[model samples]
Target: MTMTIGILTENVGVVGRFLACQLGIEYINTQPLINARPFKVAIAGSSHV
Candidate 1:
């Protein structure tokens, strides 16, 4: 059997990155790929309260 996993987050924190590293997975943004498909990253005015 084969399996795959994915983690999606707006902003990855220290713990998130650590987990990704421990799992040997890529922690990155999809901007580069989306750039070719008319997608973009949106910045918020402030962090959620």
Candidate 2:
């Protein structure tokens, strides 16, 4: 098994890149996807507020 890390944030900026570089991991920007699909997110087994 391999270990990996992914960073997801609303804004993609230098901070994300810097963290990825320092940690040697991948940084994903969710802004585009959010823009394409605006939906409500609820945690599993939890009631929506």
Candidate 3:
């Protein structure tokens, strides 16, 4: 029913979203991302911090 990818990098996230969208998987809300930096990524359903 859910698939929390647990990653939050722009490029990585783009790839994830692309794959998920193509595969018809529902992206998670707040995917717990560890060591989030450089890419300045943010999870869905949340504002950029």
Candidate 4:
């Protein structure tokens, strides 16, 4: 059997990214990972955030 890993995030942002690279898993969105899609590196909004 394979191990199951997970993460709890407020939104699709930087924290997810680091997880993607290190864990080699897909970064899911608002839904469960089973229904969610993979994510990539993208800069959104202004730097002022």
Which segments of candidate 2 are over 4 A away from where they belong?
Answer: 1-12, 28-49
Which has the higher lDDT value, candidate number 2 or candidate number 4? 4
Q: Per-residue alpha-carbon lDDT of model 4 for 1-49, expressed as tens digits?
A: 0111233232345565554455555554455453333342222111123
- lDDT, candidate 1, 21-44, per-residue tens: 655545443454443222112111
Supply candidate 4's per-residue lDDT for 3: 16
- The candidate that wins on lDDT is 3
lDDT of 4: 0.38
Worst 10 residues of 3 by lDDT: 38-47
Q: How many backbone clashes does candidate 1 have?
A: 0
Candidate with the larger lDDT of 3 and 4: 3
What C-alpha lDDT do the candidate models reach, one value each?
Answer: 0.32, 0.34, 0.41, 0.38
Candidate 1: deviation at residue 30, Å? Answer: 10
Error of 3 at 3 (Å): 20
Instruction: Report the lDDT tens digits of candidate 3 across residue range 1-49.
Output: 1234343234446665564565555554245263233223324323222
The CA lDDT at 42 in model 2 is 15
| Candidate 2 residue-wise lDDT, 1-49, digit = tens | 0112222222335554454455444444356455322211211112222
Q: What TM-score fits each model?
A: 0.32, 0.30, 0.34, 0.29
Q: Which candidate model has the greater TM-score, 3 or 4? A: 3
Error of 3 at 38 (Å): 23
